[model samples]
Target: MVVLKMKTISLKVNGITKEITVEDNELLLNVLREKLGITSVKAACWRGECGLCTVLLDGIPVKSCMTLAVETDGKEVITAEGLYSDERAKKLMESFVKHGAMQCGFCTPAFVVTSHYVLTKNPEVDGEELKKELNGVICRCGTYYQIYEAVKDAEKYYKKETKS
Candidate 1:
């Protein structure tokens, strides 16, 4: 009989460097929530379709559940927590609040992360494009309308800031 052992890898998560031993098949989401205590990245569909596990890999959104821990070595992973401190994030949070975009909160973190990507990538996105981008994320709480409005509002807020 042969036995295979997991390998330890070092990764920079939310600007902090960490070295963790994980199974070869371990997903980044598990390692993040279980090992690193980054619970903001939800563990929902695990299949990558839900986008509930979205996290920023060097500033691009990637489904953490579908990403291998080993593959994240030497890469920077930013979760919803990282965005909480950002100025744009503050505006987004305010919009979500004003629009009542958050219901159960299970999907709020993912929504926020995805919206952050949308706003950062194209701050000029219209309401239609905002809906398209948000379509990638699923909110079982049925807060779609509010979510869309929040993203659109955040886009306007961010654009105004950049132009000022």
Candidate 2:
């Protein structure tokens, strides 16, 4: 009998370092939601077109569905929950709630992840450019207006140095 080889990957998720053993072909989305109990990284659109599976890989927005679990070795993988520890993210979440950005909450995590990156990286981005940056995610609730407002409102916090 042949044994399927499993690879052990060490990575930081939601500010916690975890070592998980997974099959060589497992997707990061599966690893996050199934093996790691990170349901915020949505499993929608397994084909990689949906932004519901978004996560921050070293502060850059990435689609967890397309990323391989083995590829995350030694990397920092942050989910929506991970953002809470950072002041900038907390403000953004507040803005999202204040603006009523999320309806179903299925795709909100991806928007939060993407918007956080854009805002923190460049606090002065205009509406058009900000829209471009957030164009990757698909929101079925048609809450783009509120989402954009949330990101825009959160820009004020990004202008300052956030506390860790």
- Whole-model lDDT per candidate: 0.86, 0.89
lDDT of 1: 0.86
Top TM-score model: 2
Task: Estimate TM-scores for all models.
Answer: 0.91, 0.94
Candidate 1 per-residue lDDT, tens place, 1-164, comes to 55678888988887788889988888999999998899988887779798899999988888998899999888898888888778888889889999999788889888998888888888988778778877878999899998888888788767876788
How high a TM-score does candidate 1 get? 0.91
C-alpha RMSD (angstroms) for model 1: 1.7
Off by over 4 Å in 1: 1-3
Model 2 scores a TM of: 0.94
